[model samples]
Target: MPAALHPDFLRLPVAHRAWHDRAAGRPENSRAAIRAAVAAGYAIEIDLQPSAENRPMVFHDYDLKRLTGRPGKINAFTADELAATRLIDAEDGIPSFAEVLEIVAGRVPLLVEIKDQDGAMGPDTRGFEAEVAAALGTYAGPLAVMSFNPHAVAAFHAARPDIAVGLTTSSYRPTDWVFLPAAACDALREIADYDRVGASFISHEHDDLARPRVAELKAAGAGILCWTIRSTEAEAAARMVAHNVTFEGYRALIPG
Candidate 1:
């Protein structure tokens, strides 16, 4: 069997984008939302992408219009520009990845998802994957980096093997990998090839846990986590297959 999974990582309920509750005035990935998660005692999960400056910024979506009402790509702005942009419904502005680490202050573990638009290997891409790893260098907290792109994961591992890393995957459909080459799409659909990237864990889509490779990994003791668990029914389903869950919308069902 593989080594034991990190106890704190498995035992905690991770807040998807920091317990975002827009109706309550906190927007997803906002500093206010993150603070709410810290106060509520849930672990945090956030996305990181590079600004035009190549500094890691705490935000999701390749485009900024959804969350910020901004009209350009997120990477079009520099870190200072992004920091000045406020979330649509909240006063808090976009924050740097370093700022988030400081805000969490090791109060709880963090799962940092590195959004990789460029599928380049190694640190040459100047994408958020490398920047995220670089930013994490001085952080003295429990954290893990994950990505949908295997090349990004492998490249980050090559740069910083000390940090925990994982792969985020789902059973792929045509619409999902439309941007990728056919061969790449075929490989991603297999999902178990995550080992190519040295992923110690797999944060799989909750509904796709029944894939044979996933079951095989779980049986061999690889840490298996699931994402965006929103309701009691989904949580119950995920609990049966995943060691931990990244959840939102309501309080997660804690494990014994």
Candidate 2:
């Protein structure tokens, strides 16, 4: 039988990018943010971008400019260089997935989103999923991996079938996805690959949670989670559809 999403993931508010706060010295995916989220009693969500050596680095952007104040693509650097690169105006440098895993230490659940390696979500996505699985081997935690690219999710499930895997979905509106072709967006928007990929859940775009297909997935018993929710009101509304929320920018009350 396919693995299922763990029940603990649905019970707590997840800290988007690990409860990041730049002014507080906790940049997204930084060790400080991971520590802060663990301290706050919330499940943590993080993104992994591949470094030159295919090492999974805890980061969000494909480029290093926004986060590191540098002017190159992140994968241009090896794992060592990426690990040494510091986040803009923050004391912490980019951390490896293994380092972040050590910090969390299974204290709280972790939700990881693998940034799409295949520029257009194509099959050329390298074996980064294999690298990620190797790094996660020692982590005994309540955690799951997901990606906007269904191909990556399928690859990850193949790499570690014992672990629950999922998709990070969106409406894929053309205006918002100018980089992806309309056909690709239309195909992804339907989330038709969820079953074939062996996905157990989805962390969907919060504003798009009301989409009919999202409701259909919910009805079918997929564990529903939503992302980047920023306020109490939005959290309340999302709760009507999502089993749990991955939030940022504000404190979300833990549901009773």
- Computed on alpha carbons, the lDDT of every model, listed in order, comes to 0.81, 0.91
TM-score of 2: 0.98
Q: Against the true structure, what is each candidate's TM-score?
A: 0.92, 0.98
How many clashes in each structure? 0, 0
Candidate 2, residue 83: the lDDT equals: 77
**Which candidate number would show the highest lDDT if scored against the true structure?**
2
Give lDDT tens digits, candidate 1, residues 11-124.
889999898999988999998889998898888899987889889898988899999998899889999999999889898789999999999988888888888767522234
For residues 38-104, could you state the per-residue lDDT of candidate 2 as single tens digits? Answer: 9989999999989998999998999999989998999999989987888985786899999999999
Off by over 4 Å in 2: none
- RMSD of every prediction: 2.3, 0.9
Which runs in model 1 stand beyond 4 Å of their true positions?
Answer: 1-5, 119-124
Q: Model 1, 64: alpha-carbon shift in Å? A: 0.7
